[model samples]
Target: MQKTGIANLPLHSGKAPYWLFKRMVALSRAIVELMIIELGREELLRRLSDPYWFQCLGCVLGFDWHSSGVTTTVTGALKEALRGVEHEFGLFIAGGKAKKALQAPQEIINYAEYSGFAPQPFIYASRLSAKVDNVAVQDGFNLYHHTIVFTAEGHWCVIQQGMNETLQTARRYHWLSFTLKSFVEEPHEAVCCDVKIPALNFTAKEAADLRKAATILSCENPEKIIKEMKKIRELSLPERHMVSLSDINPENFYKIFLQTYEKQPSNFESLLEIKGVGAKTLRALALTCELLYGTPLSFKDPARFSFAHGGKDRTPYPVDRTLYDRTIEILKKAIEEAKVERSEKLAALRRLVKITQV
Candidate 1:
């Protein structure tokens, strides 16, 4: 770990200094890329898919936070993301007896405990450092974190930490999951996979409709969704009156479709006029459309991923570039220590440097 002057603060707080936090994030990307390079692509993917590694990496990712306030919030986000994906990627990573445990009705309880999401904050606070590496490599069969419960009914629930706020706190927040997915296709095309959704209470029908909306938004066709929304509007569905197609995914697939068909922007502006239909989604659509159908959209704005902080005297996080370089040098030395052939070492380093784009 490159020193960010962030390790010395209280680890359980929710208010980390902005500069240190930003620096840690930059260092994390470097570390993650380094690990990916060293492990090879196939192995790196496999490890990311593994639950043990995910938890380990997730925890270690949070280790840089000195503020207990920020640490708690960060931990909460990771836990929620893991919980939501448990049925999908999480299940695949666990197999055999581990798989059987997941199949149990009360598996959520078991997995939550196993995932270290229980109410013992004091324990988590104390164990943060030592358990970081252990959680990454331990097999579910060998050592269990929480007990598994197999109930008769299929519905699952976990003994998670209770939220301080009540469900009736805010109406707007109640329906918002806060899990926004950003799609970027540019020089280094990639998706910021599975950001954590915030805690919110939702009505049954609203939740079901939201899921359908998210599915539609995630689809490749914006015109199809527009057609479907228009039909819904025609039907006078109660929910349709309150919702807009923009709430789904805001990609203007119709812009090209319109030019080819009607030679105008009449149908295009209806979807484009929505509040959140900014440059981000437009760029995403442009890239996806071009890659899939060879129809390109115009460049809107410069792409960036930097998150500026307001509290720090504009100095964001201070990345120890010198330390990072030293770390890379040390890794090269490790390759030599392994007694690997010079040609092999050079080849490995070349591949590492290439994948990392370093």
Candidate 2:
């Protein structure tokens, strides 16, 4: 089975101090370079997609292990660390927090043009991953961070985060291309969040019937869907669904429905990719399918942990600058020497294997 899980983190504010952030970038660069050199780019991507490994990486980088900032700050440092050196490692990172997240597609396009690879598949992966977490899974968190990490060979991983203001927590979604079989199924490599509330998880395996029904409904005329949606409003829904009838306004989705109707998507994934199709639209369709077609929905919360060294927030103690710098120096020297010394490369690889085993 694929290694997938969720971690819940406390919502945090403020940024990593410049001094610490600079060190994070340097250390991240050294660690990533060594991983790419020894394990290959694809294996590096696999490790990054693992939530447990990712959280530990943040801790090792001197960030709070349980703080939501780890998701944003770690990826931010990575983007900076890999800048201008992407070609050397054959690894590329795109998208980031807030506004930077929106630039992911264009950034992927630029890299694709430079590397001579098709851009659509990468772009679609980025968008669909975001859509699945943000729309198909209604867990009350709104995504504010999205980053896609890929290689020259086109293998990719997505690390995105969402915030639930009411709960004062953040949930992260991780996706790896190699492990993802279907966007409309259990596609996440891992989802890390603290709390697991009742959520409308249309991507759950149990929701397959609902997904099919929703797709068929989307292809129907808007007028017919509007009528079915209206009829469902008066009926009582399962408490597990956690859908609010008030949130599914039929009139509000008329325009979106018209678009889906014309396109007539052949699958749930295609319908989800349609422009203007969002959480509300999907919820409306889900409710319609349940009430009219007798298809059931899955409210499974797809949420499914480590600290290395001292944390940035000074939890156990303030970051050991001396030790941190020494770690960076060691890794940097190992990477530098590995290029010229076969024995040194073997020693470094052995050390990495031991560390991972721990």
Candidate 3:
């Protein structure tokens, strides 16, 4: 069967009329429960080996904007759900190790390198600010950004200030030393990106425009918004300057915007609806929120296909369609054997069948 394009599919967050949203949530809850009760843990693992099932899990685990997260919190939730279910099915049918079977979720998670966290070099907020000071005072005021994997072991920090090579060199070199060590341990993981987050200078008119947009999104509560705005202002000049300038590209811009607006949903929604908002910005905002304030945002990467293709290695793990089909078949038989009366199981099965239509 031909696979569907992700761009053409309705955004899960944007889908469903307000009235139907409640039903959608209810249906989602039912499906999760049904999977746990009937499919069993091992079976879920076996099924998850299928690319189609992996995508289904991704969609289920996903949130409003971020999709790549699938965080430790969510992973824990999935692990907990597997409780009370039999695991022998995964081992017997899938030929995976019994002891290591429990690690399937993490294994599945590891498949996508760029999707989530792997050790990487990061900049400290203080050092970054200092670098910005040097650059801001320099002739060109040029700032460079990169996402680099640390070659060594140390704390990975997010610089709230700016990135300047001189400042980077002057720092305790702790991060750099750590990065180097990481490289020696594993030569393959050492890499980085020269990512740039352009700065924006928010004009008075632009501020007013943002305010109006916020109002339309129902996020204009004066006192509350003022407090949040204060938090946004708490950032250093370079960071604030970045926000004001709207310096980031479409990818990182949304991340920067969310830093100021995540708590202010009205602002977040309005920004997303604006003409210029794009994938990078959305991801940036989500990551900024998650990494900075420890606030939870969406984890799913909105850009990638749910089926996990498009420059992706389609064969991350060997797919086991036979085990998946057998699991489904077992689930069908279990639905029949469910201690509950046949009528109730039938009704639940009906709901399960309807989920496919979605």
Please give the CA lDDT of all the candidate structures.
0.29, 0.88, 0.30
Q: Rank the candidates by lDDT, best first.
A: 2, 3, 1
List the candidate numbers ranked by TM-score, top first: 2, 1, 3
Residue-wise C-alpha lDDT for candidate 3, range 263-340, written one tens digit per residue: 454443234333333333433333333233444332111111222321011223333345434554555555546636
Each candidate: RMSD to true structure? Answer: 22.3, 6.1, 21.8
Which stretch of 10 consecutive residues in model 2 shows the poorest summed lDDT? 303-312
Better of 2 and 3 by TM-score: 2
lDDT of 2: 0.88
lDDT of 1 at 190: 12
Backbone-clash count (model 1)? 11
| TM-scores of the models, in the order given | 0.24, 0.92, 0.21
Model 2: how far is 203 from its true place, Å? 0.4
Question: Whole-model lDDT for model 1 versus the true structure?
Answer: 0.29
TM-score attained by model 1: 0.24
For residues 1-358, write the lDDT of model 2, one tens digit per residue.
3434444588889999999999999999999999877788999899888888888899899998678899899999999999999877788999999999999999999988888888888999999999999999999999999999998677999999999999998888889999989988999888877788889999999999999999999999999999988888887765645688877778888999999999999999999999899888888888888788888778888887211223888887899999999999999999988776877778999999999999
